[model samples]
Target: MNRSKPKAPAPDEPLPVEIVDAHTHLDACGAKDAADVTAMLDRAAAVGVGRVVTVANDLTAARWAAEAATWDERVFAAVAVHPTRTAVFSEQDRAVVAELAGRDRVVAVGETGLDFYWDYSPPAAQEEAFRWHIDLAKRVGKPLMIHDRDAHEDIWRVLEAEGPPETVVFHCFSGDLEFARRCVDRGYVLSLAGTVTFRNARALREAAVHIPTYQLLVETDAPFLTPHPFRGRPGEPYCAAYTLRDLAQLRGADVAELGAAVAANAQRVFRLPAVTARELRGREG
Candidate 1:
């Protein structure tokens, strides 16, 4: 959908420490093959964005995400029928996603949850799919990454009712300080994205300050919410550096210290390898 030309933004000075992109969409970002995946990661690694978890929006994308993870050690995958696509989710679709969720490189089950902004799927359908994905994440013993867009209350309702997965992540967290406090109290991780850099997102910025260092994560949601200044342009994983810098400044924490904390949070939530094996594989290639 993002047909903008795939050009890397001017690179930021690399961070003193590396961090992982807790969520992204490589396929949607124009990464079509192993070469594309490598090239994307190369750009990201240059700015200390060392690892990524590319997530799926539908059954077809789920399969692609699984395969892409195998193409590079730095890349991991999350599979699910996005809330918007719940209108078409069938028994066969669930079977496919379940299989993908159990794959070794598939670290999370998500980009699920509710989205009231989009009417492509009815509320009942979205709720049904969200519950199913929660169960799948529990079964697979993986974190559940949520995509909440103007549907926070219902999202919270279902998550609370069905009971959340052990490791719950509010991807691109769009809640206010009060709501953030509840999520933190419930032990859910809040993943900040480019939107937090927007001048108008004052509430989100304030909420970021309240989140404990270990409960925070960063992401690009690439090809979507590019950070400020480059707001209208296409975003790549490498752009995460800008957001990391902004977040560090907002929290009044050193960039390196914040980066290290987020990296640890991502590694813990996704159960990523201690080191990025793909960087070595990339050099070998």
Candidate 2:
């Protein structure tokens, strides 16, 4: 495996409409403070990505993500202990995450769900945390952002048993057509990342076609899953523009229409403030 840092892909042409990176990590994308946040959002805004929901997978990152959201109007935060990190998740940690999740700009309680792919945390511990986060999302009245990986059935089982909050987002959705139908049927928003752009992602592309516009979302999942032709390259929020275009093409929808739909979906799913297309194109930020 190449241990070298992946270089960023060259910027793609700006999309004709607007988009929001429904899931990303500003910290991992090189944002450290307000200035860095401004600069990063600018880079994203330059290419039609007007907003992003920076997610946290741990206590410290949850704090950073919450604070980062306050730094920029275009940035939002999603706070939760990722399922993989649930082994050591404690009461104090839960307190802080709960406080952060209730903040005005902390739009979701998430990046939390089952991840059986890694044994960093036992299944029992993960389920316990997942249930707590689900309850927190309901209490805080925020959307639930899920990080389902190799645990789709279990994720669904937990969600059904817990009686999911009003809204749920399957971040970086990695399910097949059948699963996609199930999620959409239950009114869950599926946030697709750049994984759909891979050459071997034919199944994903086919699944994308069946999803309704209202239930669709797009993201970069940046610093990872950089779209094809730049597969190994580092991605930033701006890359959501590339992913949006490709998704639109794959779904056989007009780029502008799909962009508008997904942008609307993001705004609603995350309960984000309005981001007018004019402001984004004019670079008003």
RMSD of each: 2.5, 2.0
Per-residue alpha-carbon lDDT of model 2 for 21-138, expressed as tens digits? 9999999988899999999888888788888899998988999999999888888899999999999888999999999999999999998999999999999999999999999999
Tens digits of per-residue lDDT for model 1, 1-285: 867664556878898888899899999999999999999998999888989999999988999999999998889999998999998788988999999999999999998999999789999999999999999999999999999999999999898899988999999999999999999999999999999999899999999999998899999999889998788788989889999999989889999999989999999999998866445656778
Q: How many backbone clashes does candidate 1 have?
A: 0
| Cα-based TM-score, every candidate | 0.95, 0.95
Best by lDDT, which number? 1
lDDT over C-alpha atoms for residue 52 of model 1: 95
Off by over 4 Å in 2: 1-4, 275-285
Worst 10 residues of 1 by lDDT: 275-284
